[model samples]
Each structure stands twice: as structure tokens, then as C-alpha cells.
Target: MTLLSVDNLSKSFGGLMAVNDVTFEVESGSIVGLIGPNGAGKTTVFNLITGNYQPNTGTVLFDGQNLVGLPTHTIVEKGIARTFQTIRLFQNMTVLENVLAGAHCRMRAGCIAAMLRTPAQRREEEEAMRQAMGELEFVGLGKEWQNKAKNLSYGNQRLLEIARALATKPKLIVLDEPAGGMNDQETQELITLIRAIQDRGITVLLIEHDMGLVMRVCSSLVVLEHGAKIASGTPAEIQSNPRVIEAYLGADSE
Candidate 1:
């Protein structure tokens, strides 16, 4: 089943086209990789999907609802959550506090209810805390819940970001360059975490340059170059695709 359908999507910045007529679908309960070399517009496609940028043409359908003009928070409420290419944790905030922030979208208490300490608000707050802690534990940061986000090691910081995104209770999570700054061990752990996320029945869509990681985790891939989709298929098919090879390696390479 298609949880997300992006059709005829195109975006441009002034005169330069960042993404052009790209399309792909993310099936429910699958890990899909959107991959390309730098400047190939992989992130642009992500931005379009998550409502950060409006495309000049095309439609983004999430569970059959169009997401194009919706605000970012609305999109989150509609079950799509995303992380940035650069880690976007609240550095000064406690790790638990950071996760709680992600849960804010699902929270229903208004300022009046919160200020008055209504019974409903209290119950919601308790539930939010419980959910936040669970996400932290799931990402292996349960013991560091009280530490400031900046105190975590670089790789642990990445896990914290994922934990926070999970707190949103999204059906689909969009991860941008999730393995960008990790060592081999950290990357391996990430592979496991990603699989665990899929195991929990959340669809994962990611933009990653780490080919090995992409091949290992993604059931299918969408390849891009020069702001357009060049090819998309299983890992084995992409590996044998001459166009994908030429895009990553120079055409002159033997």
C-alpha cells in the first residue's frame, strides 16, 4: 500500500531549478531511500514532501490527502515527521525535554487549560512524558534523559534526534542524511535502529549518501541527478544501472 505518493513534483529557486518533475511512492511498512550525490536535489524533494517548500507543480498525497499547501505543523499532525540533514536538536534543553517538544503537536491543552492546571491537561502532560521516555529508551538514550542535548557524543546526538522524531507519533518519518557524520560503529548501530523502526511498523524515508548503509536497509531506492530522478529500483538493480554508476562515478571511469 502507498502511504505517500509524490507525483510530478517540481521546485525552483528563482531561476535555478532545485527539483524537477520528480516522483516516487513510499509503501507502508517499508524503508525507502532517496539518494544522490551532493546538489542532486535529494533534500529538495524531502522539503517538498514535508511542506517546508511549495512546489511550482505537482501534488503530494499522504494517505490520500493533498499536503501541498498545508503548514509544516499541519503536515506533522497529518502523520509525517522529518529531521534535518544537520542535527536540529535543542542543544540547551535536556534530552527528555527535547523529545517532549516533538510530542507537542499531539498535545491538546491550550494556554488556558495549562495555566489553570486543568485535570485534562495534567493527564495529557503525564502521557506525553511517558511517550517521550519510551522513545528515548527505544533509541538507546534512556539513561541520558536528563543530560543536555549538546552533551551527547556526535553519534548519540543523532540517536537523540531520531528519538525526538519518534515522539511525534508519525506514520512516516523523513530522515535527511541521517548517517552523515558517523564512524563505522555508529553507522552500524544506525542500521540496526532503522531496521528496528521498520519492525515497529513505521515507514522510513531517508536521504542518505552512505551507499553501503542505503543498500543494507532500504528495500528500494530512488536515484536523482541534476535535479531530476534518474532511476529507481531495488539495490541490486541500482548497482547494475549504468546511469546511476555514471552519476556517482565519472563517465570516464573504467
Candidate 2:
């Protein structure tokens, strides 16, 4: 049950290769981690998968369809939603408004329908509002629906990004460095939220440097170094892998 299959994916900026012939598969209903030290091209691989960048070689298949040249919005429409390594939120927008923006892809109302206040458009708007609130509640921000995005604490801001992505109704959500700026308590909460997401039957593929969080949540892991995949396996296997230790995890991983 592979939901995503990335084969021989490579991307280069000028002469420098950001990602090189990396291949990985994310199974449906599993939480997968992409790990490495900074500059290992983990985020670059994410960009390639989500259609922000086109790979120079190879194919990205989501549900058996190629996504190499699709626009980013089209990729989202195809059931793949992503968050940035840096939290990308509409800071000035209300929490609910931010989530509603993510629902735009699934919305069918055109400008004419919206302007004319057609019955179909009204129903769609109501449904989007309902979905947005549900996602906010799922992420523990239900009470803050009217708060501006910038008003949330740093960790909650991250959760808000996840909620927004969820509003897209994606089969797979790509999270880039989701635990980048969180304290221990917040990270623990994040671990719970991630598992809850999997419980909903959605697959998650994340780039995270937080090894503890990665180990706790992910059933499988792919390690990268120097823009290529070095090793991939279960947490226990990756923890004991010598090459992974030497490349990124270091001697203290044990």
C-alpha cells in the first residue's frame, strides 16, 4: 500500500546538486521520517515531492500518477499537502481564516458564483467553515479560532500550520522540520498529534531533526547525507547503523 513512490529523484541548482538520485516509498497509514544534518537535502527532496521544484531526473508517483511537472496547487489538489520548514502562516489573518485558505483547493465556487451569492456557493462556504473549525479543534486550537495567526505561541503556530494543511483533505501530508522550534512539552504534544493524524488514516512524511520525536512517531526512516540517501529502516536499525551514525547521528546516538 504505497501511497507515495519517489524514484531516482534528483535536483540541482546550477552545478551544485541539492538532491541526487534519492528514492523512497511512503506506505499508506504510516508515519515516515526523513532525517539528516542540515544541508543534507531533506527539504530539497520535500520540495521535489510537493511540486515546488521539478527534478532533473526520475519520477514522483502519488497514488500511481506522476507529479513531476504539476503546479503546486495541482499537486495539492491531487491529495498532497505540505508545510514549510519555516512556519508559513498568514500572520495577519484569523486562525479560522488561515485554515479556510487551505480549503480553497477543494472549493468549487467560481468568482461569479461567489459574487452572486449562489446557493451552491453558500453551502460550500458553510462546509469549509465547518471543516476548518474541526481541524483547529483537532490541533488543540479550537478556542483560538478568532485569534490572529501571529498571536499564537511559537509551538502553537506550528500546530496551526498542521491544521491548515489538514484542511486541504490530503491523503498524505508532507511536514518539513515540524519540531524545529519547540520545547520538550510541546514536542511531546506534537508526537501525540502526529499519531492522531495517522489514526485518521492519513499518511505522514516529515523532515525532522529531532531524533527523539522522529524515533517515537515514525515507523520507518530514511537518512540522507550530501544530497543522497544513505540508509533507511526502522528506528532501532537506523540508531545502530554505523554509516548513519558516522554521517549524522554521531557516536552518542547509542
Candidate 3:
């Protein structure tokens, strides 16, 4: 099934057309890669899908609901969550607190219910915390729940962001440059973690520059250049495609 579909999506900022009439579908339970050069507008697509920008044209359908014009929080409520290219953790907050913050989207208790601490509200809050802890553990950070977000190693900090996104209980999680800075071991761990995320049946849309990791993690690839899609196929097909080679990898690269 196509869990998320972007049809004829386009976004413009003044004179810059960041993403132009790009369309793609991410099937449920697959790791789909969105790849291109530095200025290819990959992140712009992410912004558009997540409601950070209003598209000039086209539609974004998540589980069949139109996402354009929705607020970011409303988009999150619609079961689409994403992590930014840079780590966006609550630096001063505890590792667990950051995850709980993401869970706020799932909380039913309003300001009054929260202040009065109604029995039902307390139950809901407890469930949210429990889910947060589970998310931390799922990302191998269970033992550091009490630590501050800034205190974690760089790689763990990235994992914390993922854990926070998971706390929202999203059906589709979009990760932007997840392996941006990492050692070999850290990258390998990320590969495993991404596969594990897929195993949990959550659809993943990945924006990455690391072709090695993309090839290993993604079942399919979508190539974008100058805000338009050029080619899309399985990993092997993407690697050998002449246009992808000349446009992205450069003619001299393997």
C-alpha cells in the first residue's frame, strides 16, 4: 500500500524554486531513499511533506489525507513525524523528558485536566511516560534516561531524536540525514536500527547523502536534481543508471 504519496509537489521561496512538481510514493514498511546533490532540494521536500512550507502546487497524502496547509503539529497528529537534518533535541532536558515532550501530541488532557490531575489524566500521563521509556530502550538509550540530552555522545544524541519521534507513535517516520556525522561503528548501528524500525512496520522515508548506507538500508531510491525527480528504482538500478551517474555521482565516479 502507498502509505505516503506526494503528487506533483512544488515549493517556491521568492525566486528560488526549491522543489518542483516532484512526485513519489512510499509503500508501507519500506525504507525509501530520497537522494541528490547538495542543492537538490531534498530537505525542501521534507519540509513540504511535514507542513513546514505551503506548496505552490500539488498534494501530499499521508494515509490518504491531504497534508498541505496543515500546521506542523496537526501534521504530526495525522501520524507523520520527522527529525530535522540537524539534531533538534531539548538540550537541557533529560533524555526521557525529551521523549515525553514528543508524546505531548498523543496526550488527551488539556490545560485544566493537567492542572487538576484528574484520575483519567494521571492514567494518560503515566501511559505516555511508559511509552517514552519504551522508545528510549528501543533505541538503546534506556540506561541514560536520566541524563541530559546534551550529555549524550553525538551518535546517541541522534538516536535520542529518533526515540523522541517514535514517542509520537507515527505510522510514517521521515529521517533527514540520519547518518550525517558518524564513525564506522556508529553508521553500522544506524543501519541496524533503521532495519529494526522497518521491522516494527513503520514506513520510513530517508533523505541521505551516504549512498553506501542508502544502498544497504533502502529497498528503493528516488533521485532528485534541481527540485525535480530524474530517476527512481531499486538500489542496483539506481547505482548503474547513466543519468544518476552523470548528474549525481559525476562521470568519473564509480
Q: Considering every candidate listed, which one attains the maximal lDDT?
A: 2
True lDDT of residue 137, candidate 3:
93
lDDT tens per residue, model 1, 119-199: 999999999999999999999999999999999998888898898899999999999988889899999999999999999
Q: What residue pairs are clashing in model 1?
A: none
Number of clashing residue pairs, candidate 2: 0
Q: Which digits, one per residue and each the tens of the lDDT, describe model 3 over residues 1-254?
A: 99999999988889998998999999999999999999899999999999988899999998888988999999999898898898998899999999999998999889999999999899999999999999999999999999999999988998999999999999999999989887789989999999999999999999999888998899999999999999999998998999999889766555
lDDT of 2 by residue, 96-160 (tens): 99999998789999999999999999999999999999999999999999999999999999999
| lDDT score of residue 56 within candidate 2 | 98
TM-score versus the correct structure, for each prediction? 0.97, 0.99, 0.97
Off by over 4 Å in 3: 251-254
Greater TM-score among 2 and 3 belongs to 2
Clashing pairs in 2: none
Sequence-dependent TM-score of model 1: 0.97
User: Which window of ten consecutive residues has the lowest lDDT sum in model 2?
Assistant: 173-182
State in Å the error of residue 247, model 1: 0.3
